[model samples]
Target: MRALIAVATAATLAVASPLLAATLGDDGLHKTDWMRDTFKDLREDLAEANAEGKRLVIFFEQRGCVYCTKMHEEVFPEPVLSDYIEENYFVVQMNLHGDTEVTDLDGEALSEKAAARKWGILFTPTILFLPEEVPEGQSVSQAAVSVMPGAFALGTTLDMFTWVNEKRYELDGDEDFQRYHARMIQERDNGKTD
Candidate 1:
């Protein structure tokens, strides 16, 4: 009976452990099952995301980033946030200072580092949420519907993800992200979390 109980406990822990811990890759970035490994081609990635019924999201991160670590350890591990991201976004991670080749939506080929520079990204953990139908002749950066810079608390981060996923940017109104996030916070506190 003791051995059987021990085996059951071990099985439970094995299933529960990932929810409590986020894995780090050799490249010093958080490794999640939802993040895609692709050829770093934005056009192809966008098409793939559209076909999957998901939005394209580009994540920029650097090695040894404390904010990235915080996001992976705290915000992203939350079940609600993680499940939402996995369901709505096709995420592609780019190293802020690495030499991986990338093809932009406008056919500009550059290294990952160069692409980050071209997009004016100056921080770690920058997330670019893209529209489904990008206008021709524009780069991915130019076509991005929203850019989330720096780490945020779970609520704000989740709200931003939810906003971009729901195409709230296209809605005709003056409720920008700040107002939308505030409304979401109010709603969540009122037991309306979604």
Candidate 2:
């Protein structure tokens, strides 16, 4: 009887795993277990993220964004990708067209929409990956290690997350993100997902 119950529990978890990735907030943005709730100050947020031994990630999305919904439903729900992100990143959500006040790293205060514009974010679901150590006087965008715009497939998103988390951007190799992504694709095709 105990063995049967254990098997049933495992089966239930297998079926429910994907549905556990993302949840919709009252504000209409996707929320997950890993996203942080902070005061929207980039400097303080960076400090907090570094203290937690994670890289800071800024996620931009607008209300009623189809791509954002698709990402929350499809790509982010994948356990490998979601777990990687949750383990390595401290995510902060920003509304593309919101009035929330955000303090830039350089001490500039602006509304969320204005800040997004200042950072040259022109799309929904843009993810700005920050380095662990940012310079004192730089803005968030100016100090970002990599900026991922738009939604991507599981392989691409996972590759990007891994590359940034591994600090591959700081490497002196000629293999840029494009090359790294291609290599990841090949590895996946060869049945090595990691």
Candidate 3:
């Protein structure tokens, strides 16, 4: 019994250690050292994107959301996807339940949690694609080009990334995402001969 207890205790410590090291917010999100940024800073990065003629992609997630956890653990860690995101988009990770204050590009100070609320971000792992400047006096609905919710496989995620990168949405329409994504998979399986 004593040996069993000791083993259980060790296992518990091993599991809890990493979580304890992570900074957890109200929404149960563990803010790790990597790929963590506030919404305000994300907006600033968006502005930089505008200046540099790039696109802005923001990922809103909460702690304890299974899908979000899967995304961070599985998809984001994939080398191809990670490398593409790091290079092409001004990626920002925001905690939905964090209370930290952030300053927007428009010089407005608001809590990160408040910003998530204002954006109507209730889902875990919601990815928002935005243009350089969120058109003047327009709401998020108008400014956002795409909003993808939930966790996706690396292949589908990469296809979405490629579609956005190539501005396929502009010509192909929103529903085309799935179709194009399917084709991408098929081509990859066929060794991308065409």
CA lDDT for candidate 3: 0.70
Error of 2 at 63 (Å): 0.9
For residues 44-84, what per-residue lDDT tens digits would candidate 3 score against the true structure? 67777767566787778876788877777667767677778
Task: Check candidate 2 and list the clashing pairs.
Answer: none
RMSD versus native structure for model 1: 2.4
Provide the clashing-pair count of each candidate structure: 0, 0, 2
**All models: lDDT?**
0.91, 0.89, 0.70
lDDT digits (tens) for residues 167-190 of candidate 1: 899899989999999888788878
* C-alpha positional error of residue 173 in candidate 2 after TM-score superposition, expressed in Å: 2.2
Clash pairs detected, candidate 1: none
Two-way lDDT contest, 1 vs 2, winner: 1
Among all windows of 10 consecutive residues in model 1, the one with the lowest summed lDDT is: 185-194
Q: In candidate 3, which residue pairs get closer than 3 Å at backbone N, Cα or C atoms, i.e. clash?
A: 28-63, 29-63
lDDT of 1: 0.91
Tell me, by TM-score, which candidate is best: 1
Local lDDT at 105 for model 1 = 95
Q: Which ranges of candidate 1 are over 4 A from the true structure?
A: 1-3, 11-18, 191-194
